[model samples]
Target: MPASTPRPVGASGPELHDHLTCVAAPATWLSPPDGRLAGGPGGLYVADRRVLSRLVVTLDGAEPEPRDAETLGADRVRFTAARGALAVERVRTVRHDGGTERITMRNDGDGIATVTFEVTAAADLAQISDVKAGDPPPPETPLRDGAVLTGPDGYEVRLEGRTEAALVLAPGDRFTTTLTVRAAPPPVPGFRPAPPDGPPPWARTPLTVRSADPRLDALVAQGVADLGALLLADEGDLYCAAGSPWYLTLFGRDALWAARLALPLGHEPAAGTLRTLARHQGTGHDPVTEEEPGKIPHELRPAYAPGRLPPVYYGSVDATALFVVTLAEAWHWGMPAEEVEALLPAAERALAWLGTFEEFVSYRGSAERLPNQGWKDSSDGIQHLDGTCATPPIALSEVQAYAYQAAMLGADLLEAYGRDGDRHRSWARGLAARFRARFWLEEGYPAIALDGTGAPVDGLASNAGHLLGTGLLDRDEEARVARRLGELNSGWGLRTLTAEAAGYDPLSYHRGSVWPHDTAIAMLGLSRTGHREQAAELARGLIAVAPAFGHRLPELFGGQARRDGAAPVPYPPACRPQAWSAAVSPALVTVLFGLHRDATTGQVSATPLPGFGPMTVTGVRAGGRTLTFTTEDGAPASD
Candidate 1:
């Protein structure tokens, strides 16, 4: 198998693991991991555009040597450095409107200090994609306050800051300089934008976990913090952005899955996510964006340039299905009846779209759409077993599973809410029968997808693992899928492609990478199917790998096996605080604890799996009540 594909024309490696400190707030930006905004890949990003590209600080013609850097929280970073007799500390806070960076210079020597303090700042007004591709930014004008950069159309980058011409300080004295950047002028003089509001209502729903293992505690704490920070509000509703630097915007499939996995936290977040997507549901046909009436959008972001992405794009083949599935899950998890009823129309639309297009969801874009519109959106993501790209209008196997679950679950929700769903129920039965006949292979697994001509594109992949417990597979099929997934497991997590497959690349974005959320999905399915031991093993891999990445799971990592006791290899350029990525921790905890609810009976329970360490999880809210669970000596108990 080829280790890497030739870089696509005009496409470069997405620096997923860019060593930078990202502060996401009213606006978002990246700086050197040491918290230095001294230019480079670290720049201020607002509305998916780079505002300030190069910012450097100098003292007497010398740059400070960074000594230490630490991310204080999701929206704050601090760095310490020194140059000659001056010690410098930089504190950066990302706020709702812009950012406030405070630089403190202290004189350490026992003499008066006089040195020039020059801050060279410029904005390149580049699109985030251009920046990621290493394209040159436009020319910038150095205004007296700062510099302004221009981009295509009327987009503008207004950089504003001030530095004293010279700093004079006595021994032990400190001089502080404040720099601010904004898309618009600050509301008041010296007004520092406040931090984002406290955690959402669902986040406050009393979910807590404590264990003797410090790693477990850290994972839970950081997961909560990161999820809270990733949440974005629109018209009083909340949904998480996909990730930093590249995708800090609404993504239909990503947000849907994240919200579903977060059900253990509270249903309100999921409810808001469902409603938000419904509000933006595609209302008409637009081939440019692949938008069709009733289709859920693949992404929603500020319009940067023509032909890039319209403010909204509805190209995803599975997000529409996943939307109905999430709504159904939320309703069953105890979302209010009125809220669920309000979204019934949107659910009907998504369900109708699911069946109207040739009994399969296919992307409309052949040349213009994202190469692969599913979660694996990278070009050349879907492939036949021979390393050739799967032709367009492809039907991914996992998407069929999503559609099956959506149809059945949507039927349940519609019936429960006194709506006519007989068509959905009947359609689901037919799709499942067709799927079983067409998708299952004699090799004891399912194909990766059905090609444009409806022939099975044979490949052993982790996609089949998502079929577990979705009602599309029988007992025998689920067992085969479970066993096949075990073979694909690198002993750390599930690999997207088996090693024997033709296009396998352990480090590739989709072919053979291990995505945390993907593993979490399969793990949840396994647990639901009564495969506790297998589920436990899957959860263990994620726990074992968490500490390697600061206990914060990244979007995906290399699929190198856990042999000879070597740690899992990292995927360079993966997003660290990715929404679905951070969401895996909670999802894993939910699965291991058997955290599920029965709203019809008003019961919430957890069945602790074996081999897990002694721990107590308190304040878990479900079904309008808070519950606690504890495990000791491999036994489970709850309150």
Candidate 2:
């Protein structure tokens, strides 16, 4: 299948925020507004496929009216509903391979009540891409198992109690029934979930945050919970998946960025992520999946068809560089020297791949490749200022920055690990010089990228903001870039593109949307470049909007200019509880405190900024020790 425009957000109606998503890593369930895994945008999903599409409940042929719903944990929820004289309590639990829903009905009327219950269930083994595009799935096929609805190739929905039953209950009497849905593949090796008690072996270090602002406090709390729930363990290795419902698998870029932002938590997860990705590093040139020797993959599927799309896709140019960058950062943040040493070869390969590039790292995927392979992978993501799509083999300004950072950091790592890296240092210096001369645009901001033909594709985007701390831009260049990015800020956060840009669309995913994680990175950049006031302002705006979206930021939202008293508009189909979005809270805290660690020196320190108010973050694990940040004495303190 060739890269095509993503289908529009069709008749599924407006973006739904009321729904709850319970994820058990690779296995997740998204419920509709009614709290049932029924037809619309809710189902049991595993291995990137929606297994059970329809699971509706009715009492005496009438839909149950939802009264109250609350998520108990990442994998459990409680729902209260009423249908006529019956009151119902539904507890849904998402497990590793399947889900169980227990329903308890109580007669609410004074007299005895007799009612019939019917659960209409179906399974359509539809790919996640199809589901996200609102493509109608094939018709469900009834299976041979009694009360089971299944599709071909083992997509099954099994029921224990009868699907249709009649029960009589006296006033205050209760009746309970449980239906189980096992969503597994056709006996594929290495696809099964790990044991419940013993998940992939990673340190369960607890990190906590608190602030004087209640909203900010709540946001941090929710973010911690979300990150914990989204952690997945595969073959004794734990890593954070991008998000649920659609993306419940390993993504190289998302995982790398998430791990980088999470340095305050610990280095174990970051170390695990590097090892997990290195295990699948490309070793040959396969254009179909964009494999090249030493390149890290863009994404990894749970299972793969041999002749079809490979299980691992190495289309991203940044992920490889990022992998090297993360390894260096993790080493600085206290990952064991031996563990970091083990990954030095992979880092060398990644750097060697970058050396082969003439100007900057570029994607080599053919027409069948993803239209836009950067962080903004949507169809129209990489368009010119005039709204035309940028041609492929594009050298993104940020990728150059990433490459520059990677080279410098890779050189440091090589030196620390007893390898020759003067060449890497020389290469980084030359690349930074090239970037400064080539990427700057006449509009006072950097062009988004150089198109396939080496022509600049102009856009005042947030991409240049990433250059601040990367050492790619000099002090004055960083200041100018920061000032331009500040103008594009919507008060809510930095928009992806300036509103005045020809291709800007507030609702578009990458064109004009405000992504919390993206803005967080830019804010970090601002802090690094001595723009403390601007960084604090952006932090305050993010805190203000946190409450509107349940204190857990979505993947991205509309880039509507912030007003004095208006809320940020939600982008339809934006992934909530996304890994990077969940990580923004901590990333902001990291920038606000100006936290830094030197693994060689074993020193930790902080310089807190204003607008964050008086706050304390305890139990931050870094440098192989628990450190604390407090602002109780009118100034930030560290221990």
Candidate 3:
């Protein structure tokens, strides 16, 4: 095996570990005899800290241990141990694979054993791996609840040239393969190596972004810069990572979504995400292309043989049109009209996809799914309690609006560029008209329709969040929408759903947590439509309370109702410094500052707030050129 491919592409190889290796035992727990690592639905785990680094193995008569460990794509675990003159390195790679691990020996040394690995899964995962001893690794063990069926072929090495047969395991505990095994007779030094360096955790709270907290600021800046470096760019545009451990690469929707603000902060690398996502724009509805003639791609990568997720995933109902959405927003921030013009076909095709998505994505039962395509796209994401989700023939509610808004904008861009102006405007007008007629609910307001089936997946879900931000809802409707949101937007911020709704749960990830970024979008939407009081109320409340959190707003927090002493509950497992988490704050600034740039003529406007005085944002670029803005100290009449 090639030495490069031996260890996994992004694995902790023979070196000082990066961010993924190190683990912190609570300062309270004295180091146990051996750290325990197990594999389960949660993913890979570690037992001992810095216990094992490189596990080398050699047959009794073999020369030296093979330095290369074969690559196992999915989940796996390993332990390092030595028996007699021979050394054993055990590993378990599970498929939806599961199990427990056990090791015993009779040989020259007496010491400890260690293991390392992580579990990767889409969602409903449950598996564990640990050390054990028996004829078989014990299937009935609670540790074996998710044990693998028919594990890998077992290998047995006599302990005292003793013991029975070797047990089989998955990357499952597939229990951690013991690192070093010891027999009674005598003692040789057992493997006691350092752990790999893992990604550092956020500074002990009080994380700040300004120089006043210089030490912590440098740390935060590095975190910010690393996230920036992680951007996988194509051509000139960039895509953001929501891909996670596996696909943490670029994603079309991720790019455009994050790009909405990337450029504003002088994030130049994001330019690559912009250009790349646009280049793969759809041109026709070949199931393979998911490409509807001109829709921008949802994913971009090389080596995607014909029909693979590498180059495309039509599963997303909004990426393409949003590609145009980002294009327009980019121009608004000073990228060139020519650049916008360049993506014209992509924009037009994206507009075309508005109808196509309804046609193909109707979960009515069309195609299986594509990864990283939708918000709920973990493997079991499509389905509810039932096995199968509505299906591609199904049209989700928010997607409908995303399509409408993205299409309408694409058309507006077309008209602005003087390219098929009449046709584009007509399409834009038609979509607006259609959206009002079809999506608006008579009783439940906009019935949060799951699709054309007239199914109401109704809730005051944050799903309706984009509605306000996009300017898709007009003044009259915006008022109604704002009024409706009051119930969901408690003092803290907008809840994912109203507490009264069935889908609502203060702790539910999608059901009702208060996502700061999501709340910010809703706030911007309210502010956009001149709902100043409502927007300001939200911003002030959120900003005022957020600093209690050390000024770095986390991705989200529990949306539970507030009493006096309750500290906002941080979303349990949210990633800090997430691409959008950082970006949203700036958008909040823009909303608060009332900053708007007209890409067409390159005019910058700043309407300061009552207490807020002159604000200057230098190196501000729009239409592909940089410009500066200075406001007089005096507040404008409105401000």
| Predicted structure with the largest TM-score when compared to the true one | 2
Query: Which candidate achieves the best lDDT against the true structure?
Result: 2
lDDT string, candidate 1, 198-249, tens digits: 5656455546678766777777766766777778876667788787767777
- Supply the global lDDT for candidate 3: 0.45
lDDT of 1: 0.76
Cα lDDT of all candidates, in order? 0.76, 0.78, 0.45
Model 2's lDDT to the true fold?
Answer: 0.78
Q: Rank the candidates by TM-score, best first.
A: 2, 1, 3
Model 2: how large is the Cα RMSD against the reference?
Answer: 3.9
Spell out the clash pairs found in candidate 1.
Answer: 16-573, 16-574, 17-573, 26-95, 26-96, 206-619
| Model 2, span 404-488: residue lDDT tens | 9999999988998789888988888888778778888887878898889888889799888778799898888888998888877
Which ranges of candidate 3 are over 4 A from the true structure? 1-230, 243-247, 266-270, 283-292, 299-312, 355-392, 450-452, 469-471, 541-554, 611-619, 623-639
> Which prediction has more favorable lDDT, 1 or 2?
2
Per-residue lDDT of model 3, residues 1-639, tens digit only: 113322222211121111111111100001111212222112222211111111222233222232223212112234444433324444433211112223322222343322222221111111111111101122321111222222122211111111123433222222222322111111122211111122212112212233222333333343343334234434334445532222334556665666675454543434555566655565556675465566555544332111234344545656665676777676567665565566666566666555554232333212444532555443323332222333333455556556656656666667777766455445555656766776676644564444345454445555565677565567777788888877887578888666766444566555566766677777778877787677876765566545434444555566767658766665433433345654555565456557777665676666644443444434344444454444443254221
All models, RMSD in angstroms: 4.2, 3.9, 15.0
Report model 1's TM-score to 2 decimal places: 0.91
- Alpha-carbon TM-score of each model against the true structure: 0.91, 0.92, 0.60
Using lDDT as the measure, what is the rank order of every candidate, best first? Answer: 2, 1, 3
Clashes of each: 6, 0, 79
Choose 2 or 3, whichever is better by TM-score. 2
Worst 10 residues of 3 by lDDT: 24-33
